[model samples]
Target: MLLICHAAYARDTSSDSILAGGTLKPTDAFDMGAGHVDPLRALDPGLVYDMGARDYVVFLCSLGYTQAQIKSMLLPSPGVDTSCGGDESDLDLNYPAITVSDLSGSTTIRRTLRNVGRIKNAVYFASVRSPQGVHAVVWPRLLLFSRRKERITYYVTMIPLKRSQGRYDFGEVVWCDGHHRVRTPLIVHVNTTMDGGSSSGSLGGLQVA
Candidate 1:
């Protein structure tokens, strides 16, 4: 077997996310909404740098799964666990020590992992602390199965804290290069308490499959 490593740019258009209805801050372009609350205020202003990081789609797309299907999986389920270590009262989080502008622009964000990424199971874990010192965690997964010529991407996200019910939104992973800058246009809107479970919006032509 040949172990060939390759990079690819895959376009996935997802069912519209309900978390899409929010205000995007102009200063750094962060999404703000009912669920997008911040609780990390005790830290020093120097540490205010720990606010959090998020990436919202600059555009929208019509793709895989109907709105109903997407809503079923993306929304919050009753039986799901909302706290780490099985305790919502005791929540702990380690925020990234960097800011959006600090990331390297030259580095490219990988959308898919060639053959393995498409076949194997994938998960996205997100956590945040608001200006009030409240912390929460979220786990989003992408399951994949192949059928003939078309490859489908699955999206499933879970929040692990009851307190975070309406204090967080989808966040984007970002990096910056020393010179020119490049980033994936896919932005996610994560809401734990929308009429539906959650919602998403996209920018550029980027869409989740």
Candidate 2:
């Protein structure tokens, strides 16, 4: 069997230099290079969130884009009109990271993970470290992967407890299975407006092999 590897680029903070104020700051773009262990560890990542071309179409649809606009963006565009019927909200996109640009009150997002580890019976447990003023809840706290590339779905709901302290709040959701840990960052942008507006966003990370 042929083995293909993908390298992960990590933010190399070691290249950061001390500023006049004695604060360390990154002075070069190359500072965000790959970490030593990122590639090796990424190869056998216990769980990975996978996405396809159609999945991206659904995501664009969730962004409230017109069918014409979407078609224009598609290469060798389809001859027939495409619709985003039955598509979930943009927040529910199957991505490693969770982002809510216009959060108000409470909102729930869904994510799916695929087991890509060597072990067929690997199990994982979910944990969260919520940011200030935001509460996170993950349904079906435990996941069971009995076969390679098996998929599982879960939900994360962010509830705002108080007024916005700043423009953004950060958190993370992690899945652990004795050895491997799959973590995804959570970013929520507080919008006090009642209209519940939306923003354009993208997902970044590795895909399952």
Candidate 3:
């Protein structure tokens, strides 16, 4: 078993979960964010999160990296601009997973998916598993990709309900189109009683049913 490292295919699902041993430290996603890999299903992942090199520069900028330092990481492309003009928010990066710590109130998470499967004209719908003591909803419940590599943006709003503190909750948002299921886990540490930090009241999209 001492070989090269592997990556976790899915974010978090009890269907294929392995329990942790110790009694004191009950199994939690923090213990295993990336659990394991499935070779067979990796071939056709339906909707995948894709980003360009400039996105990394933007990510770094969001992380408070200086203009000079960020410029060094980029290859010597003459006409490229590395300025962080309008970032998609720190947590709004086009990642497959979403997490919210110190969540004071309702928060809206944005994610963009690129169609990578053979089916160009695929129709996918949004499905959510709300974490304990939290209300989760996704906008534009329906997604239709006309061509391969087509990218679509979706927003997920998480509202905190009355609950316990000092614990992190787990949830997920899955996009299914009959054959393929693309899941993205939503990990949250609800701090509704916290001092500051605000969330968006808008759904960011037209429909929210």
Candidate 4:
């Protein structure tokens, strides 16, 4: 049985007659759960984002972990390089979420997705539900997969649209292949007073599809 470990990969495979509370953390959860989980949908999430044990090491290095500290954590693991020589940024981690705590200007984040559907030849197009005070766009929105587990990388460019200070806003980047709509939340915490450079022009007319 195929399993998806991340909640960001969860899809809503329910009909209109059924009420399905999704996996997104809600603002008001006093009467509801944090999120809902569908076992059937988890089994067949059309696209998935994955992270390996070694990738965490790179993430640690990006977070300013020292060489000794990183090596200490990876002890007894054979054939692993302990060098913090990678130029990979923390924002470039292969996680399915896009979050920017402070937007001082236009920022572009890259995400890679693997098509894990039963249908080998699947073409997915992207669409954006941009956040209230932010503009998000994905480049090369069309993803084509000819084989299972085929990886495709896309870039998301986000800029401040309203820049409401300390506002927590939510949006979604959705990919659909007619059968499944794979979506990821675009969370942004706006800091308007931080001299965010070039908050102008929608960062090149944000468009994904």
Candidate 5:
């Protein structure tokens, strides 16, 4: 039996549906293509985003979880200490997706990628497509992975060029290493208001297909 644990969240369900062009329901979750399992291909996935226990603790801390609350969630393990001082930025969680909510203006998000390709040194190029009325910029357009599990960080900035109140825009940022295409979906919600008050905006999440 193959067991795959999927994280459950309100956004994951809805976002997966939007990406798949399916109904907005929990049952549509597998339509995103991440749930599909192939034993043969799994044997040699070129690259993967590796997350460790510390990464999760840091992610929880960034979500404003208290030390006590975070500690309570941890299972007993040897040589593992719960620390809450990791990067508090939501975008730095080492996740496969990128999501940003509550955007009033221009904002930048950071992401790190790990290289697990069979080749020792592989170069990946970055390409991005911005949604309507939005300008997206990526720094360090070229990434070179020298060793296995080598990680690199890149930043994406989304700037609102025009007012599109309560609009959901979809874009994509992809990394091509000739053979494998590592793609990350970029979702931006425009919440421009005349008085600059809080307004409804859509959230962004990561997707790999």
Candidate 6:
């Protein structure tokens, strides 16, 4: 059985349902980094594909699921021309924007898959602590592309991050319409104590027939 040792808080289940188009089954509670190492350096990485109306991005290691499973979970959210890691402008329709909070002020980073063309692998950065709390950063060097129509997308992610004395976990989630609205349960987070510095986590999944 696949068990994820992380604590998950249901932000907006209804909104998530609307984006996923169905129910979600998550892994058991699991810890990130503590001992596990980032697996996306050369083995597993992130990926994206186009499916006619909607585009799909497979964040392989986000929840310990495979690229096939990730894509399957996102069957509901579809559209746009899939692109990643090459030209951020290519995916300008709506980029994956992240809002990070720290001691200073909150900073928002727009991550467009257009940088790497495609996700091949990812790495974790050093652990950083702020007034918001301890944060584990997962950085990936990936592979991205554009797909047309409904297609079966496949990929893998094996990155996990480690924290301080308190427990920590990491996962990925898809937020559409707005940040508060999320779906597909691909979001990564740590749920335990902080032991060490930074660690890496991966995310991947695929759409099957």
Candidate closest to the true structure, highest lDDT: 3
Which tens-of-lDDT digit does each residue in 1-209 have in candidate 6? Answer: 11111112333445441122233443222211112223332132232212223323423322244445555656455552233333232212232222221112111222322112132232212122221232322222222233332112222222223322242223343322111112111223333322243433323222111
lDDT for residue 149 in candidate 5, whole number 0-100? 36
**Model 5: per-residue Cα lDDT at residue 193:** 40
TM-score rank order: 3, 4, 2, 5, 6, 1
lDDT of the structure predicted as candidate 6: 0.26
Score residue 197 of candidate 6 by CA lDDT. 38
Best by TM-score: 3
Once fitted onto the true fold, the runs of candidate 4 whose alpha carbons sit more than 4 angstroms away are 1-35, 193-209
Against the correct fold, how does model 4 do in TM-score? Answer: 0.76
lDDT of 2 by residue, 133-206 (tens): 66677776789888553888888877665446566766777788888877777777765533243222212221
Flag regions of model 1 displaced more than 4 Å.
Answer: 1-110, 113-162, 184-209
> Model 5 over residues 1-209: C-alpha lDDT tens digits?
12121112223434653333445444322245234444555554555667777777778888989778888898976555576775587666666555665556767787777666688698989899887666777777889888553888888877666566675666667787777766666767766642343222222443111
Model 6: residues >4 Å from true position, as ranges?
A: 1-148, 152-158, 163-170, 175-182, 186-209
Residue 61, candidate 5: alpha-carbon lDDT: 89
TM-score of 3: 0.80
lDDT tens readout by residue for model 3, 60-153: 8888887799888888987666887655467877766788877767778777887777889999998889888677889889998986438888
Local error of candidate 2 at 52, Å? 0.4
lDDT of 4 by residue, 1-209 (tens): 12233333322345222233474442321211212455677777888876666667778989999878988887587777666776867887777677787865677887788878798788999999888877777887899898653888888887776566666777778888998777777777777632333454332455322
Query: What does candidate 1's lDDT look like per residue over 20-112, in tens digits?
Result: 335522322243222222233111111111111111100001222333443344446554322212211100111221111211111112122
Model 3 bad stretches (over 4 Å): 1-16, 21-27, 86-88, 194-201, 204-209
- Give the local distance difference test score of model 5: 0.63
Residue 36 lDDT, candidate 4, scale 0-100: 48
Tell me the TM-score of model 6.
Answer: 0.20
TM-score of each: 0.19, 0.70, 0.80, 0.76, 0.70, 0.20
**RMSD of model 2 against the true structure:** 9.0
Candidate 5, residue 190: Cα displacement in angstroms equals 1.7
RMSD of each: 20.3, 9.0, 5.3, 5.3, 8.4, 17.8
